[model samples]
Target: MFILADDMGFGDFGVFNGGQSSTPQLDDLSGISRLYSQHTSASPVCAPARAALLTGRYPQRTGVIDTLEARGTDRLALDEFTIADAFSRAGAVTGLVGKWHCGAIGEPYHPLKRGFDEFIGFRGGWQDYWDWTLERNRTPVQADGRYLTDVLGDEAVGFIRRHKHERFFLHVSFNAPHFPYQAPEELIGQHRRTGRTERVAVIYAMIAVMDRAIGRIRQAISDAGLDDDTLIVVTSDNGPELGGDGEESADRWNVGLRGAKQHVFEGGIRLPLVLSQPGVVAAGEDDTFIHLTDWYPSLLTHAGVTPVGSKVLDGRDISGSFTGGTVDDVPRCWQWSRYHPMPTSNAAIRDGRWKLVHPAAAGTLGLTDRDEWIDHDIKRHPENYAQPIDEESPGWPAVGTEPMLFDLAADPEEAHDLAAVHPDVRARLATALHAWYEDVELDRARLVST
Candidate 1:
């Protein structure tokens, strides 16, 4: 099985959602695959999302509720079992190429120490596309004059060539379409005519490069005749940071899904996910609402691996959705909190078509227990707050009030808040969210105190 994580934007792919940017490769490939119309990472940031993907558990469950950054040396614990470790245990030669934001500059957090036998990537959240600071098992590579996306593709193809004979799990986590979005002259000139500049230009160029690299990876898989043997998975970490570092307007992107990147709205959490395994799983769209935690059990079931959780917490084995099956019965939930006033982008939950969002209610005595996690953590483990949390930092929005709800199927843009219209859904979902968090806190408190 192989995973290709594309840091794509909302309007990036043409197969699932119609778009102006021509992505023929993704379009053609998606048609022969199953698409997740409503998929979300445990958290909207890179490190947290990656943590959830690797552990097959919620990021919060493993203290990865926020993006992993170099500050305070925060990282996934060395003893933690990662998806790559699971694959390795299953006898699959695993490797990770591209961004490794969970943690860097530490042996414990490095992919090599985290169950990946061959690691080719970097530890930073982002780097320049043309001039990158990458690594092969912590050995820095002079990307010299090559574009990052292209370099990653080269490494991926080489890895496949080196390990194609066995069951291998290659995680090609592309950092393109993220930031410092520099591109080749031709692509830039094309977008220049369209008046794309600054962040937009960078985003377009990065996506274009990423798309081309995807073609290379796809071609390599087909050439090795492993297309049928491999389980190809693709998705983005989070939504686009519209105005850059998330301080600007969403402009024409995010497709009116409401909010971007850090919020719990559709645009922030909902993502495009596709999984195809040919004879094992069929093609087409599965309008299922599942979270990153689902991949753990789902992949485990498919590969004959063991469970990551003791009592089947959070996510379910969503692989059934690949064959016209569904995860519609599972109520999708989201909860977020910020340290300050930041456009009311926090706390949300979706039960069926109804989505309830609590926007920055941290100041009120009526603050939900969900928001209390931060307050308690700050007080209980003040040392944990040692990391710098400026706007540019990874784990952000240090503080936030208000709650909103929407029927996403009817209001995908989250234009109208129907919290008043459907108080029962809000109350019940909120209660469930509160109960779940309370349980998590209890377990964490027990572990920490002991």
Candidate 2:
């Protein structure tokens, strides 16, 4: 089971030093799971990061560096080989629940066409948690009154129950704790009484609810006698969404990291990852710089299957790190740009403890707010908030003044810039990252043709 939480931060779970909300179940699971302290998302946004997670390739290669807008045509290319396709070829049943933001505009780009045997979720970036329309393999289903998070969990449990005897790849992607911070009123009140603001309380409540659902899913696995045989991976898509009256709550959720979602800071990409498989994966914590893209190769290797295609994957197989191995010296990269017709030019590089981020000059998409119908009344109700994946404005910052450098080993918060002290290191990383960006740009033809 590959469980993904939308917009959950490193400190959102008690296992990762979260104190704002109660995550008793996750905390307990962390004791038995391999907790990766330095795991990061491929991109800071949702769709691009998820694309990397599924493809084991960078989002730039997958044509998804930005989150998709509502009914947006931008999507994951059809030619890209997905992890699900790899596992299915190895004789495993695949099912995906919750958000499917990769692509939904056309039938060929749907999840079912992308190698998922079953899919129950929406394809947009964000949806109404309380009242929403979900699809079961392309058939729209109306499910009212039930919270979407619990419904997804129940569906995951059902999938597990039905496929207990077979090898199944269930992707439990929950859109919890994202925007539209909706939870049971009583649960929200529980945190509000603790002096947290409405937004903070709702966010905590949503996380608490999702954590309980995760506990249920884990128990179901054990109940079905698949605890030792089944491998479970849980992590967030990106860092927390720190916006709208969250000054006091930001510190609690961010856990001292610098930026939030949309920024290539430690707080945006540095997320917590927990892997549990009973006797297979030993229980412990490690600081492995595992990228979201690494899961494709790692999980495939864990399942003892080799990919069938001659695909160029940027991720490395780090399955050894799960069994008390170290990934101390592995280098990774990240970049982000809004949803546009063209690709992003900026990029970042992580070579061991050194980090470098250089933004690019802003490009024009020739879009105006009048072209899109922005949700204006979502904040009035506790169950709804603004969506974060809308198109970017023209004036948005495309590049930084100069390259920013930090020794993450010494400054995890990225408070100090060591570029002046270490010019050689900065130059080395810049040369490497720009080379990577050029390579990704070359791969854009695959996306454009699709």
TM-score of structure candidate 2 = 0.90
**lDDT for each residue of candidate 1 in 1-450, tens digit (9 for 90 to 100):** 445454465567755445545567777778888877777877656776787788776665565544425342236655467878878878989889888777644456668888899988776567767656677876767768888888998899898888878888888898867765578877765554244444565566567677787788888889899978888888888776665343132244555677776667677777777788788787877777788878877887887877542433566788777777645567655554432113234666667777777664444212335433443343233345445333342233434445677888888988998878878877887787666666655644553464
Candidate 1 minimal-lDDT segment of 10 residues: 336-345
TM-score against truth, every candidate = 0.85, 0.90
Worst 10 residues of 2 by lDDT: 376-385
| Cα-based lDDT for every prediction | 0.67, 0.79
Top of the candidates by TM-score: 2
- Candidate 2, residues 360-407: lDDT per residue as tens digits? 435432235543344222212212322334444556544444788999
